[model samples]
Target: MSRFYEIDPTPENYWRAIILFGRNTASYKFALAKALLELHGNGKSQVKLEELAVPYAKHLAQHIKQQPKQITSKRSSFLEQITAYNQGQLDHDGLIQQTTRLGFNNVIDAFHKVHGNDVGSRFFIDQRRSHGGIELTDNLNHLLEQLSAEDLAGEVEARWRLVEEAWANNLSRQLMLVEYEEHDQQLIGIHSQRRISLTSARPALNGYQKGRCFYCYREISILYGSDTPADVDHFFPHKLKRCDDGKPIDGVANLVLACTDCNRGAQGKFDQIPALPLLERLHTRNEYLISSHHPLRETLIAQTGASREKRQDYLQDAYNCATVFTGSWQKWQPRAEGVAVF
Candidate 1:
């Protein structure tokens, strides 16, 4: 059975749910929650809804402006809408319309409202209330305390990066701008004036993985430019399992740097549990990420749960879930034989 099965609806679990399942514009809600948790600190501080809006809007604007242009359609995204609202391009009613269109009203309802009763009842007080503010739940505040301020900030930034990458990749696929060719498993994408490129995390990941493809263990070039020839692969194929909330497992823990051949070779191999050897490599890679002070460590712990035993259990559960779709584990052998072992 999946570890996620029979999970209790505790505050920590609720926070994890948001991390695992929230996607696209809904990701801003999680960012808002984290910011609120940080700002409120230890006590039960009731913060005004308007007070939360400033930081949330700022985050949304920064993310929107920084995203790759190709991934962004001509039509403005919710992030752009939020940015516009913050920049005074939109009136209060215009902001409301954009937020509603982006489905943020549902996100707010989900966070503030209790499990049952009116879904949108009140997780936090609405603007209609005399106080018109949100009170941080004790459980949430406690959860936030598990990480230091630096760690919390790093975690939030990492999550934002993953969300941005995931959206861009998905948009490229949806628009039929990205295609996978069978020959050499090559990926072809419509190149715009500016191509989507990896950030500093690429070098960090390359160093951590010893400048080798995570799947094939072949040495990959470490060129640091837009035309650099390495592929950032989703270790767990995004197409395998559809998330009800539209979020895929695009967290750093689920990403690996690969060569063009390995990435293309594994195309559409969704819901297939990699060989035990690959899984072992992945665990080691995660350990390297944790020890190297990467923000991904926090995300890995959050998804798999803390403690080594829990992490192993979570991975086993993930493999089990994959088997349901794939019928059996799929082992990928390195195409290039006699590659230097790390």
Candidate 2:
């Protein structure tokens, strides 16, 4: 069994729990929390319900704008509301009114539930006053102090690292990969408005891998209209361990360039763990991504954990889980010899 199965439910781990196991709506709550934290700074400041709504709405708008065209109806409605407000179709009063009608108050309510009622409730203290809206405990404020303002992405990555470390130190009966897949799906859904295509990050990935298939490490083409154009493969097969909502892990950490043959020929390997070599290659490729200063680096860190030691532990845990489910693990080899491991 992987050590990740035995993570203790500590306060710090509760933060990780919220990231990896919180409800889908928790994404909005997290964004709002971060925005509030930024606004609150190092003092014990209390923001009014109306004051919080402005930044929360702005944050949600930014999130919606970054998404692909296919979003939930609720998000689409909110998007429309924000668009009208931005276009001056709605004034400040109108915007606030629309926000109430659009169900943002529900998001706020959900945020409090996650922080107060969830298993990781120890991480936060929520005081709902009859008049002053909500008050955050000093404990929550102190915890936020340790986080960086690099962005919500960075804050999530940092918390994930903490969870990874906890798992590495203890072995439990439950698998962390299951929770990870759940979390990954929610994240993909939140950002699903944008699809990742071959043309999106191919240039950077091709250069980083020196034009080789990330898995097979076989020389591949990057040019358009080539007989053997590169295929974008999910490092973690999407078909296996698919989410209950039918969403697959389409995040940057799971995607990589592959040769046509390597991709199509690898059928029946869906959701199964790749050989140790592929796992090692994925780790190295992620390092390359980080070194290149690619935005995907943040995704990789969030999904795989931060630090080199934590990354290794995460892969091992994933491998252990896959092996248990499939009964055996298969190693992927290069079709031809002398293919370098990039």
Highest lDDT against the true fold, candidate: 1
- Candidate 2 lDDT, 1-342, residue by residue in tens: 111112444333344334433444224554565555556663545655565567666665554454322122335565577777766787877766666556354555555333246453443333435544455555455455543333233444333332332233221322222122223222221222432221224433443444567766666665556665666667666543532222224655566777776777655233455777778877776665544212344556666778978877866666565566556546555554225634
Output the worst ten-in-a-row residue range by lDDT, candidate 2: 171-180
Encode model 1's per-residue lDDT on 173-197: one tens digit a residue: 3321222232333223323333333
Q: What is the C-alpha lDDT of each candidate?
A: 0.50, 0.49
RMSD of each: 14.4, 15.1
Please state the error at residue 207 of candidate 1 in Å: 21
Number of the predicted model whose TM-score against the real structure is largest: 1
TM-score of each: 0.43, 0.43
Query: Which ten contiguous residues of candidate 1 have the minimum total lDDT?
Result: 113-122
